[model samples]
Target: MNPQHTRAFAKAAGRFSNTDRIDAVMLARFGALMTPQIRPIRSDIIRFANWSPPDER
Candidate 1:
């Protein structure tokens, strides 16, 4: 998984320790609470949605 959002969450939490254990806990909390979207898969859905007719959409 990309660490981008995890890092962002850490920053948002005002964390600066950068320890592996702390990062792991932070990532777990981020995953559980935020449940960030999966990206490339979402792109495919967006493309289909955009191409669909207004009624279908």
Candidate 2:
């Protein structure tokens, strides 16, 4: 799904305010329900550096 459309849907669903915390929650919900494809990192170092649970991040 397009980011624009996702934002629009979130707005319609009463996410009127945009903030880092709120965006993270919204994206987490979206990812859980939508299960978007995750592209693998080309390098193990890069992946390891970036890897963390959402809560940890």
Candidate 3:
């Protein structure tokens, strides 16, 4: 998984109050119930190109 996805999964997991086993079960159930979304996959070059510099473009 990508860093963004990992972050998102962590954020989702953080929202729940449960033990690791329960969280794993919840994640599995959530994954099973949700339809997958297809997001655009950017290469490192594309990602960098899209990033604006702190001072200027």
Candidate 4:
């Protein structure tokens, strides 16, 4: 889920303050209301696997 969108939604709902409590509520509500596409998080290992080492000079 997009944090910016969630925060913006919270702001639109008059939740001006940002706290863990507010974030939790906003995230839950956003997920429930928006039903955004879910995707897996890329790990650091996956990033390194996509890179190649430089050849010797």
Tell me how many clashing residue pairs each candidate has. Answer: 0, 0, 0, 0
Candidate 2 vs candidate 4: the lDDT winner is 4
Q: TM-scores across all candidates?
A: 0.54, 0.50, 0.36, 0.62
Which of the two, 3 or 4, has more lDDT? Answer: 4
Predicted structure 2, TM vs. truth: 0.50
- After superposition, the stretches of candidate 3 with alpha carbons farther than 4 Å from their true spots are 1-15, 38-42, 45-57
Q: Which ranking of candidates, highest TM-score first? A: 4, 1, 2, 3
Q: What residue pairs clash in candidate 4, if any at all?
A: none
After TM-score superposition, the amount by which residue 42's alpha carbon in candidate 2 deviates from its true location, in angstroms, is 11
Strongest candidate by lDDT = 4
- Give per-residue CA lDDT, model 3, range 1-57, as digits (tens): 243554466567664544787656656655665535657766987888899868764
lDDT of each: 0.79, 0.75, 0.61, 0.82
Q: Per-residue alpha-carbon lDDT of model 4 for 1-57, expressed as tens digits?
A: 777888788889888575888778778888899999988868987888889988999
Tens digit of per-residue lDDT, candidate 1, span 20-48 = 88888888888899887775767878888
